[model samples]
Target: MRQWLFALGGLLVWTAHFFAVYIAASLFPGEPLASWLTLGLTLVALVVVGWLGLGAWRVWEARGEDELRPWLGGIALMGAALSAIAILYAGLTAVFF
Candidate 1:
Protein backbone atom coordinates (compact mmCIF):
# COMPACT_ATOMS: atom_id res chain seq x y z
CA MET A 1 0.00 0.00 0.00
CA ARG A 2 2.72 2.41 1.00
CA GLN A 3 4.85 1.50 -1.99
CA TRP A 4 1.96 1.99 -4.38
CA LEU A 5 1.17 5.32 -2.80
CA PHE A 6 4.75 6.49 -3.13
CA ALA A 7 4.89 5.48 -6.77
CA LEU A 8 1.63 7.23 -7.63
CA GLY A 9 1.93 10.25 -5.39
CA GLY A 10 2.82 12.71 -8.13
CA LEU A 11 0.07 11.50 -10.43
CA LEU A 12 -2.45 11.67 -7.62
CA VAL A 13 -1.47 15.24 -6.83
CA TRP A 14 -1.75 16.17 -10.51
CA THR A 15 -5.20 14.62 -10.71
CA ALA A 16 -6.39 16.48 -7.64
CA HIS A 17 -5.02 19.77 -8.91
CA PHE A 18 -6.63 19.23 -12.29
CA PHE A 19 -10.04 18.64 -10.76
CA ALA A 20 -9.70 21.52 -8.33
CA VAL A 21 -8.82 23.90 -11.14
CA TYR A 22 -11.71 22.64 -13.23
CA ILE A 23 -14.15 23.14 -10.39
CA ALA A 24 -12.80 26.58 -9.58
CA ALA A 25 -13.09 27.66 -13.19
CA SER A 26 -16.63 26.39 -13.40
CA LEU A 27 -17.59 28.12 -10.19
CA PHE A 28 -15.98 31.44 -10.99
CA PRO A 29 -16.59 31.55 -14.73
CA GLY A 30 -14.83 34.68 -16.03
CA GLU A 31 -14.07 36.00 -12.60
CA PRO A 32 -10.48 36.77 -11.54
CA LEU A 33 -10.96 34.52 -8.54
CA ALA A 34 -10.67 31.49 -10.76
CA SER A 35 -7.29 32.60 -12.07
CA TRP A 36 -6.07 33.32 -8.57
CA LEU A 37 -7.20 29.95 -7.38
CA THR A 38 -5.53 28.23 -10.30
CA LEU A 39 -2.26 30.02 -9.67
CA GLY A 40 -2.30 29.01 -6.03
CA LEU A 41 -3.13 25.43 -6.86
CA THR A 42 -0.45 25.24 -9.53
CA LEU A 43 2.20 26.50 -7.14
CA VAL A 44 1.14 24.04 -4.50
CA ALA A 45 1.09 21.18 -6.98
CA LEU A 46 4.54 22.03 -8.27
CA VAL A 47 5.95 22.12 -4.78
CA VAL A 48 4.43 18.82 -3.83
CA VAL A 49 5.57 17.15 -7.04
CA GLY A 50 9.07 18.53 -6.62
CA TRP A 51 9.25 17.15 -3.13
CA LEU A 52 8.11 13.76 -4.32
CA GLY A 53 10.63 13.83 -7.14
CA LEU A 54 13.41 14.62 -4.69
CA GLY A 55 12.49 11.71 -2.51
CA ALA A 56 12.35 9.42 -5.51
CA TRP A 57 15.75 10.66 -6.65
CA ARG A 58 17.21 9.90 -3.28
CA VAL A 59 15.81 6.41 -3.41
CA TRP A 60 17.18 5.90 -6.87
CA GLU A 61 20.61 7.11 -5.82
CA ALA A 62 20.62 5.00 -2.69
CA ARG A 63 19.41 1.85 -4.35
CA GLY A 64 22.96 0.37 -4.21
CA GLU A 65 22.79 -3.26 -5.36
CA ASP A 66 18.99 -3.45 -5.09
CA GLU A 67 17.24 -3.82 -8.43
CA LEU A 68 13.57 -3.28 -7.60
CA ARG A 69 14.13 -0.14 -5.59
CA PRO A 70 15.76 1.65 -8.50
CA TRP A 71 12.92 0.70 -10.77
CA LEU A 72 10.38 2.01 -8.30
CA GLY A 73 12.28 5.25 -7.85
CA GLY A 74 12.74 5.74 -11.58
CA ILE A 75 9.05 5.24 -12.23
CA ALA A 76 8.11 7.64 -9.46
CA LEU A 77 10.56 10.23 -10.72
CA MET A 78 9.21 9.98 -14.23
CA GLY A 79 5.69 10.25 -12.93
CA ALA A 80 6.62 13.37 -11.00
CA ALA A 81 8.17 14.99 -14.06
CA LEU A 82 5.13 14.20 -16.16
CA SER A 83 2.80 15.46 -13.48
CA ALA A 84 4.68 18.74 -13.22
CA ILE A 85 4.37 19.32 -16.95
CA ALA A 86 0.66 18.49 -16.91
CA ILE A 87 0.01 20.71 -13.92
CA LEU A 88 1.75 23.65 -15.55
CA TYR A 89 -0.11 23.22 -18.82
CA ALA A 90 -3.48 22.89 -17.13
CA GLY A 91 -2.87 25.83 -14.86
CA LEU A 92 -1.87 28.08 -17.75
CA THR A 93 -4.85 27.08 -19.87
CA ALA A 94 -7.30 27.48 -17.03
CA VAL A 95 -6.00 30.91 -16.09
CA PHE A 96 -5.74 32.21 -19.64
CA PHE A 97 -8.75 30.58 -21.19
Candidate 2:
Protein backbone atom coordinates (compact mmCIF):
# COMPACT_ATOMS: atom_id res chain seq x y z
CA MET A 1 0.00 0.00 0.00
CA ARG A 2 1.02 3.61 -0.51
CA GLN A 3 1.17 4.14 3.24
CA TRP A 4 3.61 1.33 3.74
CA LEU A 5 5.87 2.51 0.94
CA PHE A 6 5.87 6.14 2.04
CA ALA A 7 7.02 4.91 5.41
CA LEU A 8 10.00 3.06 4.00
CA GLY A 9 10.73 4.28 0.48
CA GLY A 10 13.63 6.41 1.53
CA LEU A 11 15.61 3.58 3.05
CA LEU A 12 15.12 1.62 -0.14
CA VAL A 13 16.42 4.50 -2.24
CA TRP A 14 19.35 4.82 0.11
CA THR A 15 20.28 1.19 -0.39
CA ALA A 16 20.27 1.57 -4.16
CA HIS A 17 22.28 4.77 -3.82
CA PHE A 18 24.93 3.08 -1.70
CA PHE A 19 25.42 0.34 -4.21
CA ALA A 20 25.52 2.71 -7.18
CA VAL A 21 28.30 4.84 -5.74
CA TYR A 22 30.41 1.98 -4.46
CA ILE A 23 30.03 0.04 -7.63
CA ALA A 24 31.03 3.01 -9.73
CA ALA A 25 34.08 3.50 -7.56
CA SER A 26 35.21 -0.11 -7.76
CA LEU A 27 34.17 -0.88 -11.29
CA PHE A 28 35.51 2.19 -12.94
CA PRO A 29 38.50 3.27 -10.95
CA GLY A 30 40.79 5.80 -12.60
CA GLU A 31 38.23 6.72 -15.21
CA PRO A 32 37.30 10.39 -15.37
CA LEU A 33 33.98 9.64 -17.00
CA ALA A 34 33.12 7.24 -14.28
CA SER A 35 33.85 9.78 -11.62
CA TRP A 36 31.63 12.32 -13.29
CA LEU A 37 28.95 9.75 -13.83
CA THR A 38 29.06 8.90 -10.18
CA LEU A 39 28.67 12.53 -9.30
CA GLY A 40 25.75 12.87 -11.69
CA LEU A 41 24.18 9.79 -10.18
CA THR A 42 24.61 11.23 -6.72
CA LEU A 43 22.80 14.40 -7.69
CA VAL A 44 19.99 12.52 -9.34
CA ALA A 45 19.64 10.28 -6.33
CA LEU A 46 19.46 13.32 -4.09
CA VAL A 47 16.62 14.80 -6.13
CA VAL A 48 14.76 11.54 -5.92
CA VAL A 49 15.23 11.44 -2.17
CA GLY A 50 13.93 14.97 -1.80
CA TRP A 51 10.88 14.25 -3.91
CA LEU A 52 10.11 11.07 -2.00
CA GLY A 53 10.61 12.75 1.35
CA LEU A 54 8.22 15.51 0.45
CA GLY A 55 5.70 12.96 -0.75
CA ALA A 56 6.05 11.06 2.49
CA TRP A 57 5.54 14.21 4.51
CA ARG A 58 2.42 14.98 2.54
CA VAL A 59 1.14 11.47 3.10
CA TRP A 60 1.86 11.75 6.81
CA GLU A 61 -0.08 14.99 6.95
CA ALA A 62 -2.98 13.44 5.13
CA ARG A 63 -3.01 10.56 7.58
CA GLY A 64 -3.27 12.95 10.52
CA GLU A 65 0.02 11.67 11.84
CA ASP A 66 -1.15 8.26 12.87
CA GLU A 67 -0.69 8.01 16.62
CA LEU A 68 0.42 4.43 16.31
CA ARG A 69 2.86 4.96 13.47
CA PRO A 70 4.06 8.50 13.80
CA TRP A 71 7.56 7.22 14.04
CA LEU A 72 7.22 5.55 10.69
CA GLY A 73 6.73 8.83 8.92
CA GLY A 74 9.42 10.54 10.92
CA ILE A 75 11.89 7.80 10.20
CA ALA A 76 11.22 8.04 6.49
CA LEU A 77 11.97 11.73 6.53
CA MET A 78 15.10 11.22 8.59
CA GLY A 79 16.33 8.41 6.44
CA ALA A 80 15.93 10.48 3.29
CA ALA A 81 17.88 13.34 4.82
CA LEU A 82 20.62 11.09 6.13
CA SER A 83 20.91 9.34 2.83
CA ALA A 84 21.16 12.64 0.99
CA ILE A 85 23.96 13.72 3.28
CA ALA A 86 25.75 10.44 2.72
CA ILE A 87 25.50 10.89 -1.03
CA LEU A 88 26.91 14.38 -0.86
CA TYR A 89 29.71 13.23 1.39
CA ALA A 90 30.65 10.47 -0.99
CA GLY A 91 30.66 12.77 -3.99
CA LEU A 92 32.70 15.44 -2.26
CA THR A 93 35.21 12.94 -0.95
CA ALA A 94 35.64 11.47 -4.38
CA VAL A 95 36.07 14.89 -5.96
CA PHE A 96 38.70 15.88 -3.45
CA PHE A 97 40.63 12.66 -3.62
Candidate 3:
Protein backbone atom coordinates (compact mmCIF):
# COMPACT_ATOMS: atom_id res chain seq x y z
CA MET A 1 0.00 0.00 0.00
CA ARG A 2 0.97 3.62 0.54
CA GLN A 3 3.24 2.49 3.37
CA TRP A 4 5.34 0.68 0.83
CA LEU A 5 6.50 4.03 -0.41
CA PHE A 6 8.27 4.55 2.87
CA ALA A 7 9.68 1.07 2.62
CA LEU A 8 11.08 1.80 -0.83
CA GLY A 9 12.67 5.12 0.00
CA GLY A 10 16.02 3.54 0.69
CA LEU A 11 15.78 1.53 -2.49
CA LEU A 12 15.05 4.60 -4.52
CA VAL A 13 18.08 6.33 -3.10
CA TRP A 14 20.18 3.30 -3.88
CA THR A 15 19.08 3.11 -7.52
CA ALA A 16 19.93 6.73 -7.98
CA HIS A 17 23.29 6.28 -6.31
CA PHE A 18 24.02 3.23 -8.42
CA PHE A 19 23.47 5.03 -11.67
CA ALA A 20 25.32 8.10 -10.49
CA VAL A 21 28.37 6.00 -9.84
CA TYR A 22 27.96 4.19 -13.12
CA ILE A 23 27.80 7.36 -15.17
CA ALA A 24 30.64 8.93 -13.26
CA ALA A 25 32.81 5.92 -13.84
CA SER A 26 31.96 5.86 -17.51
CA LEU A 27 32.54 9.54 -18.01
CA PHE A 28 35.75 9.66 -16.06
CA PRO A 29 37.48 6.37 -16.59
CA GLY A 30 40.95 5.83 -15.11
CA GLU A 31 40.84 9.08 -13.18
CA PRO A 32 41.99 8.82 -9.58
CA LEU A 33 39.54 11.50 -8.59
CA ALA A 34 36.65 9.57 -10.17
CA SER A 35 37.42 6.50 -8.11
CA TRP A 36 37.61 8.53 -4.95
CA LEU A 37 34.44 10.36 -5.82
CA THR A 38 32.51 7.14 -6.41
CA LEU A 39 33.86 5.60 -3.24
CA GLY A 40 32.83 8.57 -1.14
CA LEU A 41 29.39 8.67 -2.70
CA THR A 42 28.89 4.96 -2.17
CA LEU A 43 29.78 5.24 1.52
CA VAL A 44 27.36 8.05 2.04
CA ALA A 45 24.59 6.16 0.24
CA LEU A 46 25.11 3.07 2.40
CA VAL A 47 24.93 5.07 5.62
CA VAL A 48 21.73 6.79 4.62
CA VAL A 49 20.00 3.62 3.47
CA GLY A 50 21.18 1.74 6.54
CA TRP A 51 19.77 4.37 8.83
CA LEU A 52 16.43 4.34 7.10
CA GLY A 53 16.29 0.57 7.25
CA LEU A 54 17.03 0.54 10.96
CA GLY A 55 14.44 3.15 11.61
CA ALA A 56 11.84 1.12 9.76
CA TRP A 57 12.72 -1.98 11.74
CA ARG A 58 12.52 -0.19 15.06
CA VAL A 59 9.17 1.29 14.19
CA TRP A 60 7.85 -2.07 13.09
CA GLU A 61 8.96 -3.65 16.34
CA ALA A 62 7.41 -0.93 18.39
CA ARG A 63 4.18 -1.18 16.44
CA GLY A 64 3.98 -4.91 17.24
CA GLU A 65 2.27 -6.47 14.22
CA ASP A 66 0.21 -3.50 13.34
CA GLU A 67 -1.29 -3.48 9.90
CA LEU A 68 1.09 -2.52 7.10
CA ARG A 69 4.00 -1.63 9.38
CA PRO A 70 5.45 -5.11 9.27
CA TRP A 71 5.33 -5.16 5.52
CA LEU A 72 6.99 -1.81 5.39
CA GLY A 73 9.70 -2.87 7.79
CA GLY A 74 10.36 -6.16 6.04
CA ILE A 75 10.61 -4.56 2.65
CA ALA A 76 12.76 -1.76 3.96
CA LEU A 77 15.21 -4.18 5.52
CA MET A 78 15.33 -6.20 2.32
CA GLY A 79 15.92 -3.09 0.29
CA ALA A 80 18.72 -2.07 2.62
CA ALA A 81 20.38 -5.44 2.23
CA LEU A 82 20.05 -5.30 -1.53
CA SER A 83 21.45 -1.81 -1.63
CA ALA A 84 24.43 -2.71 0.53
CA ILE A 85 25.27 -5.69 -1.64
CA ALA A 86 24.81 -3.76 -4.81
CA ILE A 87 26.92 -0.92 -3.56
CA LEU A 88 29.69 -3.26 -2.46
CA TYR A 89 29.69 -5.01 -5.79
CA ALA A 90 29.75 -1.69 -7.58
CA GLY A 91 32.52 -0.45 -5.33
CA LEU A 92 34.70 -3.51 -5.89
CA THR A 93 34.16 -3.24 -9.59
CA ALA A 94 35.00 0.42 -9.45
CA VAL A 95 38.13 -0.35 -7.50
CA PHE A 96 39.33 -3.27 -9.58
CA PHE A 97 38.30 -2.02 -12.99
- Which is better, 2 or 3, measured by lDDT? 3
lDDT comparing candidate 3 with the true structure: 0.80
Q: Candidate 2 regions off by >4 Å?
A: 63-66
- Count of backbone clashes, every candidate in sequence: 0, 0, 0
Q: What is the C-alpha local distance difference test score of candidate 2?
A: 0.76
Error of 2 at 28 (Å): 1.6
Task: Arrange candidates, best TM-score first.
Answer: 1, 3, 2
* Superposed Cα deviation of residue 86, candidate 3 (Å): 0.8
lDDT of each: 0.94, 0.76, 0.80
| TM, every model | 0.95, 0.79, 0.84
Best by lDDT: 1
Q: Candidate 2, 55: how far from true, in Å?
A: 1.2
In candidate 1, the residue pairs with backbone N, CA or C atoms under 3 Å apart (3 or more residues apart, or in different chains) clash, namely none
Which model is ahead, 1 or 3, in terms of lDDT? 1
Candidate with maximal TM-score: 1
User: Which 10 consecutive residues of model 1 have the lowest summed lDDT?
Assistant: 59-68
